[model samples]
Target: MNESAATITKPTPLLIELRGVTKIYGSGAAAMSALRGIDLHIDQGDFVAIMGPSGSGKSTCMNILGCLDTPTDGDFFFEGVEVGRMNRDKRALLRRHYLGFVFQGYNLLNRTSALENVELPLIYRGVPRAARRARAQAALAAVGLAGWENHTPGELSGGQQQRVAIARAIVTEPRVLLADEPTGNLDTARSREVMELITTFNREHDLTVLMVTHEPEMAAYAKRQVHFLDGLIVPGPNQGGDA
Candidate 1:
């Protein structure tokens, strides 16, 4: 099938599926299991929050779901394609085409302007200079940073810097956004502002959001919430968790 035709024939609903997923570190009796038989599915356009306390394995699960790590056992399927068994190069290609990430630290290079930071992903994707700049500018504009593209991270407030990071994450318009403690370092008000932007992106753009957070209020913005304990996910309140 041609590329466009092949894409058109793919299933539309389920975006991510993990079956009997497990991660093990070390070896012999000293080994540690991160995720224990995780079976889950996340649909396209769904907003989900994964909540847990420290050492609950949520981080491992998030890493696996984001294609940052592969499971020692079990299978991972993204858009009906089995990715867990893929090699590193294949996984990297999938990540470039399918996922965007936002993390706690802004992670912007000090010397780079906001626009340049946002353009990094496109550069990796082999987008041309002119088109990459245009798309980066539009993404910044979407995040309300139109005139501040020339500003470096140091010149911007914490909130503005975070927004710039968000713009960078969304610039590619990937199928899924994996957010790990996106607002953990921000003050309450700034946290709210960032959350509003994330929710707005999910609501209006149909971006599939899978966010890992320890805060109950942050999870409340998501349509579904899952909590992890002792490396297993258990049923919990939609937003707030014991964490």
Candidate 2:
């Protein structure tokens, strides 16, 4: 066999990356820094937990990662594309196509059924009614809420509502799932159920996951945890303690 023929080269793109990231609110003396000169990387299919105390910039970082907010300084790359430099419309499009978000509040439509709420993203993307309905139903089933599709949030328990939210997030088949305190509103048993579902989705679908959690038990579900304090990453073993 020829040496040239045997040679193989391929590079895996990082699903998310931040370099020298900084976030500042206001300006001058009144300005408050959220994230300061931070560098972080997450590859495809990796589960990362971002843990930090209140006002430690973890939320800011999650916003930037989810394309919900732009950094005041430095670069943010998503799947080899520079998201920080993209215009607002481009950023919006990027988020619509590549990102899914699950929040502590389980931002589902209060008046809508679980299936309809799960279909909202697809509806925004101009997916036809039939296709969106089918996909939404499938997503609901994936989250173990097959029979709850017709129920509204008010009719479900906290865990069920969160399950609907997860179904909505995954219905789009996004490349990255940004979960901000996803289990924050659930009880211990419910939290375990939610985390197990998330873990299964991450492993079976090969989805990249980035979660922000103040609870150590919640963060333990992730493969690796990165701690933040006073706007910077806390290096060493101390990083694993309570946020």
Candidate 3:
């Protein structure tokens, strides 16, 4: 083969994957299946939005992806490492070093300054105080909150608080961002602003994004959408998030 042929690229592997994954709660007559041997794979730097109605299993899947829960059967792989084989501490380390999350409620401490809240994850990682403070400041600046870092959550507007939450999520330069209804609490204008910031990060940082949102407008920001129904991923466009 010529050198050019030798340089041809290979198909990229999945950044995250699930194979025949299942999750069942309780047992016997009281059992509830949250995922029924579902298979999914996500490429790095892709943004995917997950949508489903109540009891449709989207949240359960999100919990598993976030490492907050384990599948009852099958396997989950992250960067080709079988997550199911990892002990709790290893999983925690993976989450700490690679995953970032933003929630619908903005999940910030009511009395903490925005900068301090952004520094919380670093604190858990044992980052030195000075470095954490500097990184937190930089993250706030990236999210357009530079001058407002010292404001407490209660002192900030809903949009501002959510910005702080976004700042905190990205402060670690995490590889994947998991956002659940990130704009749920904001007005239309604020929601647009937040989405714009997220989109910029995905484009510029090449951050892989997995978002869960029932609102079609919010999900529209994603590159694609995955619909869930009866514990399995379904084909076609979203079914309007109705179970």
Candidate 4:
């Protein structure tokens, strides 16, 4: 195609898009609307942070973006595919292939070694044992936990556990990383360390990152910030600019 034609025909795919999304818990009088007509789009390779106080619908938005839950109304599109009405198994598959999750609590099996914990996703995907071990080892090393591969969660510090959790999240080489309060449990120093790792991954791998954080400093680590208030997105100067 010619330059003009190419420019006109080219399509920019969004990593995640929410069009008039509304999430409500319960029904009728008891219903609690967690999200109110959210319209958001995250482009590929963008690092966006969702910030809001508790009950502001940030977590609800994250859940919808992560495929953990569906919107009560409107649509959610991931990589140009509608996912709002996907079956549980399809949504699980979508998450496995396209998204990774990191959480504040650093969810890890207490008795499992770091390497084993990181290998869980690959195991679920039925990767070969040898490949799983190799990939898990590399992931752990990437997160600066090279020598801690054999250590269980109980044997690691809070920061170390969080590193392991991050290792696990990226082991599958997902296209997007959803981190909800990733640094919530860490001290200032540890939080910075974790953010540095996350930033490195985003830059080096061109990974799209969507994070939910209440701390302004944490949100500042992201390239853009989207604020939420009263179940709706709040317009701000940093809506899609440098946070």
Candidate 5:
């Protein structure tokens, strides 16, 4: 099999889809467009990395995909549901129900124990206390953090903190995992560990992962890579067309 074939097999029915997604800031001639009519789809179990230089609009795309920001004009469908049309409360509900996020900084609360951090989402969803604790512990154990649950972020190393973050993000068994520069702050060894953890979850749990990164090495871990240039989607040197 070819190298590309060794990576992503083929596109199935997409869990994340975007059409004519545009984000414009400002007005008139001074109007700046962050994303310009981008069309993309990512199937279930696909691990995609979005790459671009600074100001290339990849970050904006990440925000839109994560439901943290709405597009200025366009249609976005998540798991066949029209998410772009939902109100703020509904959007929050959808995010809580179907999306998980990890970031460069591993934003675990300083005051909360790792276990509590993982349980926060379940609490927000009104999960019963006992069930929430059980699931949170299970998620942490999945990430190889079984004995570290009582530690706080300050007590863990960079890699450990990120594992806790990943544990928190996946505890809900979200439909999609959105990671923005997940290893930007880690050392090479730590970054590789984090990427491997993510890849394992993608392969074993069938989680759809969309990650944003500028590093080619990091992007290589994904099943497909999409490049952006000047606020538009451009074909990356390694991308296998619109698969």
Candidate 6:
């Protein structure tokens, strides 16, 4: 047998990984380093809450994980494939097929019905209208908005609007859900409600969830917490991603 064939290596089992990942914006003296030699790992079905003060690079890390931005140095692996090297079009397909996102701001159209809003991702994938409607309706129902499908964003309450956003995010059944301050715009009661629903999804679907939130109460809902500061992760609990 050949030496190369005898030394076969198994691919990493992690769903997401960042090794020596650094992101620098601009050039020369104008450059701002957002991530400083970060090493993190996320396993399948891991729910991680990324906490930090503003400008701590948590958002930058989130952007890189969501494929919205690229790292200036090091490697990002999704399913052991180096994502940092994938071109923009390939990244878009990865986002469409494997990732879902929810923002603090409910990015819904004011005039569009909740069902249509939930159907948007499916439309992007060229799903037929009937299938899109069925999936969207089921997604809305999963988020506790069964009868409110026809209501526009302007007609829904703040909590209801956020739920609609969640429905839209999960309608595609993505493997990783990237949530940026998902409950930031809601009241305390509503925030807890949203957290409960998120927790339920993480449990029931075994979803890999990465949520960025500064609120401790919200972070507590996650299985593990990762703290960031001054463009680096704090040592201790989050020294490793699964910690």
| Top candidate when judged by TM-score against the true structure | 5
RMSD of each: 3.7, 5.4, 5.3, 4.7, 4.8, 6.3
Q: Write the per-residue lDDT of candidate 6 for residues 76-113, one digit (tens) a residue.
A: 99989999878899999999988999999988988999
RMSD of 2: 5.4
> Which lDDT tens digits does candidate 2 get at residues 92-200?
8888888899999998999899999999999888899999999999999999999998999999999999999999999998888999999999999999999999999
The list of candidate 3 runs beyond 4 A from truth reads 1-13, 238-243
Error of 5 at 105 (Å): 0.8
Regions of candidate 2 where Cα sits further than 4 Å from its true position: 1-12, 236-243
Writing each residue's lDDT as its tens digit, candidate 1 over 1-243 gives: 113422442344787999999999999999999889888889877889898889989999999988889999999999898999888898898888888899898888897899999999999999999999999999999988999999999999888988998999899888888999989989989999999999998877778899999899998898888899889888785534432
Model 4 TM-score, all chains together? 0.92
Query: What's the C-alpha lDDT at position 149 in model 1?
Result: 94
Clashing pairs in 5: none
Better of 4 and 6 by TM-score: 4
Candidate 4 lDDT tens digits, 1-243:
012321332343566788999999999999999999999998877899899889999999999899999899999887688999899999999888778899999999989999999999999888999999999999999999998999999999999999999999999988889999999999999999999999998877777799999899988899889988889988654444322
Measured on C-alpha atoms, candidate 4 has an lDDT of 0.88
TM-score of each: 0.92, 0.92, 0.91, 0.92, 0.93, 0.92
Query: Could you tell which candidate, 5 or 6, scores higher by TM-score?
Result: 5
lDDT tens digits, residue span 45-82, model 3: 77888888888898899988888778899999988888
Backbone clashes counted, model 6: 0
Query: Where does candidate 6 have its weakest 10-residue lDDT segment?
Result: 1-10
Stretches of candidate 4 exceeding 4 Å from the true structure: 1-12, 237-243
lDDT of 5 by residue, 218-237 (tens): 99999999988888888887
> Which residue pairs collide, candidate 2?
none
Question: Positional deviation of 160 in candidate 4, in angstroms?
Answer: 0.7
- Weakest lDDT window of 10 consecutive positions for candidate 5: 1-10
